[model samples]
Target: MPKAILKLYLILKRERFDIVQYSTTNAVFYAATASWLACIPVRLYAQWGIRYVVFSGLVKIIFKQIERWCCRCSTVIEPDSMGNLEFSIREGLYPRDKGRVIWNGSACGINIERFDISQKDIWRTEYREKIGCDVHHLVVGFVGSIRADKGCNELIAACRSFFSNMPMARLLLIGDKVFYSTIDKDLRDWVESSDQVIHVPPNDQIPQYMACMDVFALPSYREGFGMVIIEAEAMGVSVVASNVPGPADAIRHEVTGLMVPVRDAVALAEALQVLLRDPAKRTAYGVAAAAFARDSFEQKKFLQYVLADKEQLIAEEEFQINHAGKHV
Candidate 1:
């Protein structure tokens, strides 16, 4: 870790960058510290999500302190979601002044044109057939890591209970199980054995899978920002997400998607059933969701926002430099 920090510090010093941004646990901690030491004018720790929330006791304390240190070194603590910024400030993790959330709360936002494949009916049909889905199937899809934190277990249980009545219904789970997966044995076994569930190893063809889905679901326990929900929205897929910070911001309950209580399989099942049963409501939500994604969370707009922010910060930095020079 120290060597990596030193290497990053040297790179920052050599580059003399106006801004340096990093995310995740180790990268944020090391890179922020390095950027601070290198005296970069803008050291940004772009926190994607809070990992320490899942831990407890001394372990959680340790991780929180490490994150606090990382934030201290950073000029800005940029959380992707407003809820995350509020949580960090409320917890005293970072000075409220230093924290900010970018437009509409996503890591980078989604490309609407890329996910706007609703017109590609042929590919959608072929993809569904390849994934073992029949024309009769009512597919609900999830795209993310398969872990306890992601509420994969809850989704599995919910699908099993709910989809039993409709054998034609399918659960399409994308992404692979990580080495240290905290998800239930039921999820692990079901992924391999269950005829009702279809598992696709983690790949880049998410929009393709999204095209085949009737509904998208994200029942995460916690999230910095539910980027996947926005992606699904871009694909004109109605979602059922957990009523937590990240997903809450990504989805508007009853407007674009439904929000169920976190970790509650029954509520999750019931919510999914609503969309599955009511084709008209589902279509309405999907249409609204696509409009929302295109209007607010387009990738180009977000990139422009970030670029403008950097330009403003650079101008401020230059003014300070000039002011200091005149005084000297």
Candidate 2:
């Protein structure tokens, strides 16, 4: 890895590159090491979150050391949110002064104007009719990958419990399965046999489906600022999510949506029941959620912060290069 990085750095250096931007932890480590070896001083690292470190064992400790080394080599380390910045500080991975937060969590959010509910009535009707989720059935939806870490299993359990009480409610699941074979047989049977549960394949029509649902649900065990939460909110769908870091940061409890503990199927079911029974409350939450997402997680604000951070990192790197040149 070191040798290949050094070779690539020599090639890029000869090409006269002005700024170096690195994404992901492994790439940042290699880029920082290669830049130091090649005497190219302009280096910047972008972090979504420390996933490997938080997920793995001894490797996580090593990742922390590697991150510290990369942080020292790079001119700046840009994190996606204040929540991530706090995590880095608590983990002792990077100095607080070295980290910068880009606005609105995601690097780029969904195009809000394109997902307007007014333009989606036909699609909504088609979705409703196709899934047998008419006006009589209150639909609760889930979007994103079907993984245990994403709490898809918990969602299924919650839906089973929710449907037992509110038989008229429907579960709308959107996204491709991450490991279809690994899922429990009983759970698969339940999803297929249950008339109330409808599984949609991953498609470009996410916005249309989101608009059709009364409430959007995701009870993830881990997330580094989920873009889907903002997407659902922008489509005027009320959300019910796990009380984890990213979801908690995105959702305002009872105002925009309800939040339950991670992996609490009963709590998720109860929350679903609340939205299912009360049509007026659901609409109120949907309107409030849409307004909140537009004001907070819009794409324009995110782009502005990312661009500014990039420029500032470049300028600092240039200053370091000039200072080193004077000493030589």
Candidate 3:
């Protein structure tokens, strides 16, 4: 690790970088260490999420210490969500003043133009028919890795409950199941056995798949920020997400969509049932969610915020250099 840091420091020193940004835990530690050693003018650590939150024992302690060191070494810590920022501060991973959230809080916001509702009907027909599901059926969509921490078991349970009550309801699981080996065997068995459950491999046409759905579900145990929630919203789809930090930040309970307790299959099922049964309420929530997403999580607005931050940082660096020159 020391040798790697030394090599990185040499590169940074030679390059004379004005800004050094690191993402993920490993990159943050190594890059921040090198940047600090190289005396980079602007050191940034993007805290997308914390993986060690789910761990225990000495492992958790060691990871926490590493995160803290990275945070201390960086000039700025930008967490993708307010909830995550608060969590980091509470855990003493970083000081509150050093951190700031971008826009409403997503790594990159949704492209409202691409995920347009105008194409919803077209894509809905195309995908639904492909899956042999009629237009009247309520498709509860999920787009992400199929894994344990993502609440796949809870989602399957919720779907089972929902399907029992409403046979017209279908589950659309879209992602690379092959890569996510942590998926429960029961969930896999249910998907394979049930005709109503459609497990499509991950594809580029996420917007089309999202449009086919009347509602989206992301019952993740934890997230830095739930970008897909806003993406689904941008497509005029109501969401039922876990009441964890990331999803909570994106969803406004009862207004935009619904929020259930983390890993609570029964509560998730109830939320899905409510949306599926009440078409008027579902449409209202979807409309409000679309408006909220466009106003808050648009891609253009997100980029502007990021560019503005970079400009400010550059200005500060210039001011410091000028002051140092005057002092000399």
Clashing residue pairs in all predictions, respectively, total 0, 0, 0
Candidate 3 lowest-lDDT run of ten? 178-187
Provide TM-scores for the models: 0.94, 0.87, 0.96
Q: For residues 1-328, what per-residue lDDT tens digits would candidate 1 score against the true structure?
A: 5999999999989999988889999899889889999999988888898889878999999999998899899988889988889889888998888988877778888887778655646657888989988677899999988778888889988998867698889999898777425867766676678798888889987888898899999999889999999999888899999987778889888999999999899999999999999999998998899999888899999999988877877888899899999999
Of the two candidates 2 and 3, the one with more favorable lDDT, higher being better, is 3
lDDT of candidate 2 over 135-159, digit per residue (tens): 7778889888776777777788888
lDDT of each: 0.87, 0.78, 0.89
- Which tens-of-lDDT digit does each residue in 156-221 have in candidate 3? 888876597688889999987754557667767777899789888888889989988999999998
What are the RMSD figures for all models against the true structure?
Answer: 1.7, 2.7, 1.5
Candidate 2: lDDT of 220? 84
Give residue 85's lDDT in candidate 2 (0 to 100). 70
Which has the better TM-score: candidate 2, or candidate 3? 3
* Cα lDDT over the full model 1: 0.87
Q: What 10-residue stretch in candidate 2 is worst by lDDT?
A: 47-56
Candidate 1 segments whose C-alpha is farther than 4 A from its true place? 118-120
Candidate 2 overall lDDT versus native = 0.78
Look at candidate 3 and give me any clashing residue pairs. none
Clashing pairs in 2: none
